[model samples]
Target: MSESLQTLQTGPSAAAPGDFGWHLGMVLRGYQFLFEEAVEGMPAGIRGYQILSTVLHRDPPNQQALGAHLAIDRTVLTYLLDALVDAGVVERVPAPSDRRARKIVATDNGREILAQYEERVATAESELLSGLKEPEADTLATLIARLAMDVHRSQPGSSPCEAMDHLP
Candidate 1:
């Protein structure tokens, strides 16, 4: 077995000084709980925010590309898009180049809502990382971003969160 796998298999008492999996898992769990709460009022919670944010950031090529960028299933993306439309956060405009297809776009209200959600999410993130000093937290965030970029580059179509889909 690989050294890392072995380290995780042994309980803390018998394991190496720190187990990466355990630490990462604990952090993810904490963030998930906090994030769920932070975006609870959103259309589909975190997912709705993701779609809205993506639209605000770019001119989507089409619904399929949007779903691919997010690593969301096409069918699921449709449902999320419907909710976002109902919430007045996003709209499907006819694709300029392909009249047959629709492109997702954010509304002015969507941008405003995203800004509010950003504040809440940032606060939740700060609370989750409160154990770390500011500098330490910044360092951790930088390192994680680098790692995510590497994963994204390694798997051309995989988003950082869904990079695991490309793993063996």
Candidate 2:
């Protein structure tokens, strides 16, 4: 067939080790496993970490905006928030601009938890990039972040998250 098809059929070459997807998949899997272990006792695991970080760092979106941004369903986000609230990690506060709207905010305990785990998460991430040297890791991080932003900009609002249903 075509040259490109032939290349694809050959799989990873001896020198290349892996294609982009292979590398990305490996990193994703590694982080998921490591992060799970790191945040073992946290509610919702990785999702909980994401929620805590977002609420702590971002402008603190309301439930609807939070769900949309995170690609979590309204119902599911509601349940997650309930758990987070019960855990004393987050609280539902009235939006400043609109009292009718409720926004998610991290409690002092939540901020402390985020601070406590930040170093742990960083260490796990560093372990994932153990193959790279210090400079290489920094360069790779910069390049990957730039690439991610480019990809995001290229796709206005075509996130696969929109089409996919929340997994059980």
Candidate 3:
């Protein structure tokens, strides 16, 4: 077998299929697949979708503050924002308090696109979590949210996931 396959086979197995790590990897891959397939027509990838959604919810957030919140580095965030700006999905405005700071805001077109993507994403998520009942899914979400909040609180500079760096 290939080295990668052998490594996976020998790794830890906290869940049924493989170790917790393996399961996490599979889950992330699944999410990526769904996001790519579902948002094919959208101008942004999953990360862009997330950033657009976040900006819509929290309008006019400075680039640095937004990057910190989303755990995205300045370089990647710049590229993502540039793409969104090019697509007319988001706009960068001057900060009210700081002339040097640039704030991100979603445009009307961006909001409409996000709304469509939201429905698609929700459907995809429901399908992905079909193994769980509604209540179980809700409980799982709550638990995950709590854990995430705790981790964020404990780690001052750490973001949720490194992959999320593409989003903010």
Candidate 4:
């Protein structure tokens, strides 16, 4: 196993109740670390991959909707989209219903890169959760997805990705 994966499986030393946040921070860092190598060539690391994934999956109505889903600022999203466009991975198209509004779409190259990234990410995730049995891992995934959706619903206007960061 890779060193980072090993470290994550073993984890840091235990923490006191009051240090729960610290422990979670370490855990999140480990997860990010696992993806670091896989996303090395991508723009904005995981965030950029997320933007691509959102574009491919949700087919959101426009740039604003895309930003809302990812919880990225409008200006930041524009900057990121610019890079993706330059890379020939994505495009901003004229919205059919409104000339002023623009929609985001993935080009063929974007779709191919996204497909490759998704495969690598899936492998990394499976390794990250190697300690869990299949059923347990599935349960954890379900719970986390539900939690994120619930938070997103409760906090209107906040991106589901950012919603987790807002928890006390």
Backbone clash count for every predicted candidate, in the order shown:
0, 0, 2, 0
lDDT of candidates 1 onward, in order: 0.84, 0.77, 0.80, 0.83
| Candidate 4, 117-138: lDDT as tens digits | 9988988888888989999999
Q: Give one digit per residue, the lDDT tens place, for model 2 in 50-157.
A: 788888777655877777666677888888899999999999999887899899999999999888777788888998889999999999999998987787678645
Candidate 3: which stretches are off by over 4 Å?
A: 1-18, 159-168
TM-score of each: 0.80, 0.79, 0.79, 0.81
Instruction: Write the number of the candidate with greater TM-score, choosing between 1 and 2.
Output: 1
* TM-score of candidate 2 versus the correct structure, residues matched by position: 0.79
Considering TM-score, which of the candidate structures 2 and 4 is the better prediction for this target? Answer: 4
Clash pairs detected, candidate 2 = none
lDDT of 3 at 51: 88
State the displacement of the C-alpha of residue 43, model 2, in Å, after optimal TM-score superposition. 1.8
Ranking by lDDT: 1, 4, 3, 2
Per-residue lDDT of model 3, residues 17-136, tens digit only:
335656656767787788777787776586698788788887635889888887877998999899999999989999888989999988999989999999999888888889999999
Cα lDDT of candidate 1 equals 0.84
What is the Cα-based TM-score of model 4? Answer: 0.81
Winner on TM-score (1 vs 3): 1
The residue ranges of model 2 lying beyond 4 angstroms of the native Cα positions read: 1-18, 156-168
